[model samples]
Target: MSSENRTAGSGRLLTGLAWAVLLLGLWLWGREITDGSESGSSAPTTGDVAAVGRPPGVALPAAHKPLKPAKPQRVDVPSIGVTAPVVARGLDTQGAIEPPPYETPHTVGWYGNGIEPGAPGTALFVGHVDTETKPAVFYGLSAAKPGERIRVTRADGTIAVFTIDDVQVFKRDRFDAQKAYGPRDKSRAELRLITCGGAFDRKTRGYTANVVVSAYLTGVAEPRAG
Candidate 1:
C-alpha cells in the first residue's frame, strides 16, 4: 500500500459533519430544499461565514437543465488537479454521511441515498482532505475558486459539468448544515463538495471548520468513447 493508503489518525475528516449532525439534525430538517438565484457577489471575508457567493466580475455559465438520475462514476476538478473514482456511501450510525475509507483516500464518497449527480437536486460528495501521511483527493478543495469547473462522469457515460459558484469554510461552532448543504436553486442541479478545513484541533481530535464548495450544473458532455 502507498503512503496515501496508511490509516489516518483518530481524527476522521467527517468529524465536522458528525458534529453538524449532532447540532443541526443533518439529513432530516437540515437538508431542507430552498430556492435562490446565483448572485455575482464577492466571496466572504471571513472563514466563519456559512456560505460564500460568487466573486464579482466572474461570469459563470448559465445552468444546464437537470439530467436523468445517474450514479456518479468519477469526479474531476481540473483546477485542483483532482481526479478520483466515486463510490456510494451511506450515513453512519451517528447520522453523518460517511466519507471514503482511510485505505482509499483518493476516492470520493457520494451520498447514495440522496439525489444522484446531474439530477434536479443537490448532490453531496465528501472526501478526505489528507491522510495520516499525505494529502488526499480533496486536499486542495479549499483553493478552488468560483467559476472553476467540477466534472462528474456519470454511470450513464455522460459527464455532468458544474461551475463553482461559491466556496465557504464554516467554523464548526457556526456550521449551518441547512444553508451549507441545501440546494441553492430548486430548478437547477447543484453539487456540494465537503472536506475538513481550518486549523486542526488536537484537543478535539478534528479540524476547526468544514470547507464546502458549491456548484451548479452548467453543461453536459457526451459519453466518452471506450
Candidate 2:
C-alpha cells in the first residue's frame, strides 16, 4: 500500500515541530469524533463533488434510511471483490489512524474507538491497496462506481448496507481530515472506504493520493449463514 503518500510525508521530513505541525494539519487523521461530531452540514453540490481518473456512480442502488447501531464484524464490497475482516484500530504515535499492518494486508481496519458502522456518524473502514509483493483487499477500490452495494455484517445477525454516493481522490496536500472523515449529514449513517491511489512514487514506494469511496446507509438484511 502507498502508506507514505496517503499519510503524506517521509518519516525524515516529519520530525519534531514539523511532525506536530503535520499532525495538526491532519487532525481528522485521529478520527476521534464523538460527542462533538457535527450535524446537518450542507450536502455536497454536484459542482462540489470532484472526480479523478475514473467516473463515479456507475450502477448505484436506491438510497436507504439509516439503521440502529450494530457492531460490524466484516465488510464486503462486491463491486471490488472484497470480503475482509474488520478489526478495530486507533491513531498511531504519529497521530495518524493506523492501517492494518502489511503482514495482514487483506484485513480492513475500522476506527473502533469512534462511531460504530450503520450508526449515526461516519464509520471509517480502511484497507491496504497493495503490499510489497502483491495487491491487497482494496487494490481495485478506486474503480468502485455508483450503484454498488457495500455490506457490513455486525456481531448480531444483521447486515448494514451502504450505497455508493461518489468517489473522491484527495491529494496528500489537499486532504481535509475533518471534512473527509466526518459525517456530512450528522443525522445520517455514512461509510468511508479509504485506500492509497494516484500515481505510485518509486522514490517513496507509495501513492501520491488517497482514493476515498464515500457512501451512505442504504439498506439492511438478515445475516447469511456460512
Task: Give the number of the best model, judged by lDDT.
Answer: 1
TM-score for candidate 1? 0.84
**Whole-model lDDT values for every prediction:** 0.75, 0.65
User: What does candidate 2 score on TM?
Assistant: 0.76
Off by over 4 Å in 1: 1-9, 12-25, 29-47, 50-53
lDDT of 2 at 201: 53
* All candidates: TM-score: 0.84, 0.76
Worst 10 residues of 1 by lDDT: 33-42
Clashing pairs in 1: none
Candidate 2 per-residue lDDT over residues 134-219, each given as its tens digit: 56777788778766789999987689988877677656556566655656777778898877655655565445566678888888
RMSD of each: 5.5, 6.9
lDDT of 2: 0.65
Model 2: lowest-lDDT 10 consecutive positions: 39-48
Off by over 4 Å in 2: 1-25, 29-63
